[model samples]
Target: MLDIFKAIILGIIEGITEFLPISSTGHLYLADYFIKLNQPKSFINMFMVVIQLGAILSVILIYFNKLNPFAPSKSHQEKEATWQLWLKVIIAVLPSVIIGLPLNDWLDKNMTTWQVIAATLIIYGILFIILENYYKKRTPSLTKLNKLSYRIAFFIGCFQVLSLIPGTSRSGATIMGAMLLGTSRFVSTEFSFFLAIPTMLGASVLKLGKYFMIGNAFVGNQLAVLLVGMIVSFLVAYISIKFLLRYVRSHDFKAFGWYRIILGILVIIIGSIFA
Candidate 1:
């Protein structure tokens, strides 16, 4: 079915950018310019959030190799360390719940427009450039997640709430916030990954709940589309995460900024030409 193809394409987009700080929603909004889908706004919007579970699963899958990943060593001193990491993630996620979800109606009504997306893409692109320059000065290589402070994590979460705007990247905002708060590129990148699991899972669950309540629940065809999207997203996200980590080790996020800039310009140009 054509619906299945659309789901697959959107799923690929979700997987590729969900963790990259490139704004998956922004990309999806742009993707709408080309790949047409007849999905109702209720489903289309919710599907964007739901498919993210696929990308978040990739984080857990790839990082399961860590020895004490979310846990500190077994020592008493380190015992609380792992729990503390979880606490930090939870604290960081709190702001989005308070700020993002409560504002869902307002945002859905106003911010889900190409104009808002283009504006955010440009504004956030400048912030990314500024933050990248800031990182050049405060280069701390505290690779351990335990080194991340609660306050810094909360601030990162605050920045994440900004990503509720379509073109604003949750990973980008959090990483840039962490970078400003003294986290190294690698540490911030990893933190973004860890934070994404909880955030994306919460989002997907919420969407699923709403869809179920509305009784627009996936039937045979919709179920097929959902499954296809999940499988494709898992595959693409795995590769994207691997490639992004390797890419970040060698280069700055400037390349992504340029890409955002180009995309933003295209949005404006396309809107003008067609309008």
Candidate 2:
């Protein structure tokens, strides 16, 4: 029962932070530190990765029509556009797969520390503030999704490689990269949403595969905890995604930037005290 409650809390954290420029992994690490689930380190690690599937599903649920290539009501042009969008999403995720897979274990072993997370949070937070200011005076060149080129998509994937560092957010890296390349905030944000579907799904599968390969499958109670976490995360992420899309239409991300900076400093302080 206690574990179930913890799962719910973690789920809420995952849902809220997953799409935000703030790193979900960073927040989860902090949560797990304080909550200190009694599960093995291995199980805990698997749980964190697997639970993100819930948030990924929220994107799929909300953007089904936009992302779907086979909608019955679609014109040929709309279907073609959807396929092209998927291709761009695919291109954007390739760099992460190429880089992240080989380094996953190393990052987990070395970079998952509080000190590292805090440092990344501060660094990227500052980057966001600076970028937002730079963007304010400039008009975006690529206002429409179709205006986004394959070259830009691949370059954005290159930026996503930076997110291999624990606190460097995947959406933050990609969205910032897109904007710097002349894509508007709305286009970039929506592209980030589409990009997450494959990236996170692949990650969840890999984590689950690793868990099973090591002969550590979830048993009955653990399974229940996992399900509860995923379900709650899905519900919360649905709301979070909707809120972000609505929020970005009229506002910039400066607030998230400041929030990241404050959170990072607090993490550093807390980590020092705890250490």
Candidate 3:
């Protein structure tokens, strides 16, 4: 029962932080450290990655009509545009997929540390604040997904590779990259949502495969824990996605930047004390 409670807390944390510029993985790491789940290291890692599927599904559910090219209610032009969007999403995900596959193990070994997370959180957080201020007076040139060129999409994908460093935050990298490339926050955020579907689904598959290959047996208790986490994350993420979409309309991300910096500092402080 206590373990299940911890799962719920972690799920809530994952759902809330996943869509925000905040790093969900970083938050989960902190949560796990403090709560101390009685699972093996491999199981814990797989649980963390696979539970993100729940958050990803929230985006899919929220934007299903927009993401689906074959929606019966769509006009011909809209369908074509949806297909184009998917193409751009694929383009935006390819760089991470190609580069991330081979580097995964090395990164897991070297980069998944509290110090790295703290540094990235503070660094990207400051960047977000600075960028928000710099662009406050400027108008975005690319307001729509269609306005984004393939080159720009590819560049966004390239930036996503920075997220190979655990706490760098994949959505943070892509959203900042898109904004820097002249795309509006709306388009950048929405594209981030679309891009997450493939990226996270692929991650879940790889993690599951690795778990089995390492001879981790799939059992009832483990299955229950995963399901509980995923379901809770899905529900919380649904509300979070809606909130963020609405929040960005009239605001910039400086608040999130400040939030990240403060959280990073706290993580570092807490980590040092615990260490």
Candidate 4:
């Protein structure tokens, strides 16, 4: 029962931070530092990656119509537009796949430490605030997803390669890159969501495969904990996705930037005290 409750807490953390500029994996690492689960190191690692699939499901559910090229309600032109959008997404994901795949193991082993997480959290947080201020006087060149060019999409994917560092949120990196390339906040946010579908799915598959290859199998309450975590994450992520969409329409990401700075400081302090 206690393990199940911990799962719920972790799920909520995942749902809340996964799409936000705040890094979900960073939050998970912090959570584990305090609420150490009574599971094997291997199982715990797999659990964290696999549960993100729940968040991915929420994105698919919310954007089903926009993402689906075969919907009966769409006109031919709209269908074609959807296909083009998908192609752009594929282009945007290539940089991450090419770079992240080769570095996954090394990053997992070396970069998941608190020092790295805190440093990135503070650095990106400062970047967000500075960029938002800089853009205040400038007009966005691209306000709509349809207007986003393939070249811009590819560049945004390059930014996602930074997210392999653990504390650099994937959405945060992509959205910042898109905005730098002159996209409106709404367009940047939406494209970030689209980019997550492939990125998170591929990551979950890789982690799961590695877990099984190591002969790690869920035992006793482990399976139950995993299921509860995923289900809870799915429900919470649905609400989070809706909230972000509404929030970005009327707000800049400066607030998230401030929050990240404060949180990073707290993590550093707490980690030092504990260490």
Indicate which candidate wins on TM-score.
Answer: 4
Report how far residue 224 has shifted in candidate 3, in Å.
Answer: 1.3
Return the candidate ranking by TM-score, descending. Answer: 4, 2, 3, 1
lDDT of 1 at 169: 87
* lDDT, candidate 1, 152-234, per-residue tens: 89998888888888788888888887777777777888888888878878877877787779787655576677778888888
lDDT of 4: 0.92
Stretches off by above 4 angstroms in model 4 are: none
| Cα-based TM-score, every candidate | 0.90, 0.97, 0.97, 0.98
For TM-score, candidate 2 versus 3, the one ahead is 2
Off by over 4 Å in 3: none
Candidate number that wins on TM-score, 3 or 4: 4
Worst 10 residues of 2 by lDDT: 29-38
Which pairs of residues collide in model 3?
none
The model with the greatest lDDT is: 4
Q: Write the per-residue lDDT of candidate 4 for residues 157-241, one digit (tens) a residue.
A: 9999999998989999999999999999999999999999999999999889988997787799999999999988999999998
Give lDDT per model, in order.
0.79, 0.88, 0.88, 0.92
lDDT per residue, candidate 3, 149-247, as tens digits? Answer: 888888999988998898888889989998998889998998888888998899888888988997888565777888888899999999998998898
